[model samples]
Target: MATLQQTEHNKTVDAKNFSRRAALGGLLFPAVGLFLGGCTRGLTTAAAPKVAIPEGRGAFALRADGTRAFRNHELVDQNGVKVRFQDDLVEGKVFGATFQYAKCEGICSDMTQQMKKSYQLMKPIMGKPVNFYMFSLAGDSPAEMKAFMQAHGIDNLPSWRFFTGSSEAIADIRWAFGFGDPNEETDKNLAGHTGMVRFCNHKLDKWAACPAQGSPESTARLVVRLFPSNERPQLAGIASKIATPSYPMKNWSPAKPLTANLASQL
Candidate 1:
């Protein structure tokens, strides 16, 4: 009687296992299809941002908001000087724009470092004209902006432009560029907020922004094709040399030790 009971239990277990396998197999394709559909829907759901400033390199273009941008909105430069966004626009080219504050202790810092790495990656063509604009969402005060430039070694770098306006004005600018994170309340870490690199296409009047918190390099590469002066600077030539095998313009390499260390706490 004991042996018969044990055999019956084994048979029951085998039947259950087979049924589960069959069910899971039947669900696999549908599950995969749903996942892919969700991703596709997510990407195409929103219209790409438009260029609102109509006077500068993108004067003829429209922003994601379907509005034209001003040539130079009142923004403070890294030197604490009020400068126009189109002050240094090179005719016939698109550019990349993003916002960051100097005092940012979290994602902002990483974002800067990432752009710096990207700048290094494209260093060989430093003198040539390509648009790269960075605005300080915080608008570090004139004194703060001056000090921040020195601290970060951007005191002489002309390739990047920083800007800041009033809190309300900045919010409008952020919305125009799609910079601020919408669901900021739930994010516990720096990356929890929305962060993206905006690439403005002057000719097409379109832009592409990336949200992957770790993909600035890829974003840089996408822009690199537009500006192909392919000479990378050496570490020794930098204003301050870094120890890693950092390809000069590629300031944020695949591994940024400082950023990597910070990632642990995030």
Candidate 2:
């Protein structure tokens, strides 16, 4: 009888050991699965596809709000030439414009520098006529604009023009461009303004804007992208060579932020 009891006790002990092992294995299996799952997620995130900005085809459309915001207002260029905004600046050419003040010590300097670089890049393959205009938010005079350009070591590129106008007319231009409050104060004791480079293929009705703080490469790319593919067959090869600019982190108040993917596409 004792021998029989011993056998039964041994069987119970064996069963208990098996149950413990099974329970440990169940816990370990889940832990292993979680670790593998985490690794897989990391890999997937690392290998995620980057967003490419479309080229070769016109992927972006001009904003109706921007087009409507423009008016046929008159302003003066750097050469002291009196010109209308619609007829002179935006009528027949590919145009790019920026809001700046000669007295501004903040982003305007960076903006002009970037513009100069973009001008250099675009001047080569621009194919057709292209123009860049800097409209003074502070109502700088032609002399003041010229002095500012000289101080910054900016050469007079054929495609670029610095412009100023009466405060009311300037305000009208500012409003039409949809830049921030023309009365807003800037860091250099200048009027408040927007820091953006607006570009458009007026003939094609395609327009877009980017932060003036962006790299010249990106800004130039944006300008180049505005050209219709069919209009500039030569651009196909040149567009492939230009590097996309990195998206700016700083926001132009009252204007939508330019995304990295969008900058890449532009």
Best by lDDT: 2
Candidate 2 positional error at 52, Å: 41
lDDT by residue for model 1 (238-259), tens = 3334466745674555765667
Deviation in Å, model 2, residue 79 alpha carbon: 2.3
**Cα lDDT tens digits for candidate 2, 154-255:** 635565678887665565454344442211232123434567776666545565778877877777767766655444424332356668899867855576
Name the runs in model 2 displaced over 4 angstroms. 1-70, 125-127, 181-192, 233-266
- Which 10 consecutive residues of model 1 have the lowest summed lDDT? 32-41
lDDT of 2 at 38: 7
Residue pairs with backbone atoms closer than 3 Å in model 2 (clashes): 53-265, 184-192, 185-192
Q: Each prediction's Cα lDDT score?
A: 0.46, 0.55
Show model 1 residue runs off by greater than 4 Å: 1-72, 86-93, 180-193, 211-217, 225-266
Q: What C-alpha lDDT, on a 0 to 100 scale, does residue 37 get in candidate 2? A: 6
Global CA lDDT computed for model 2: 0.55
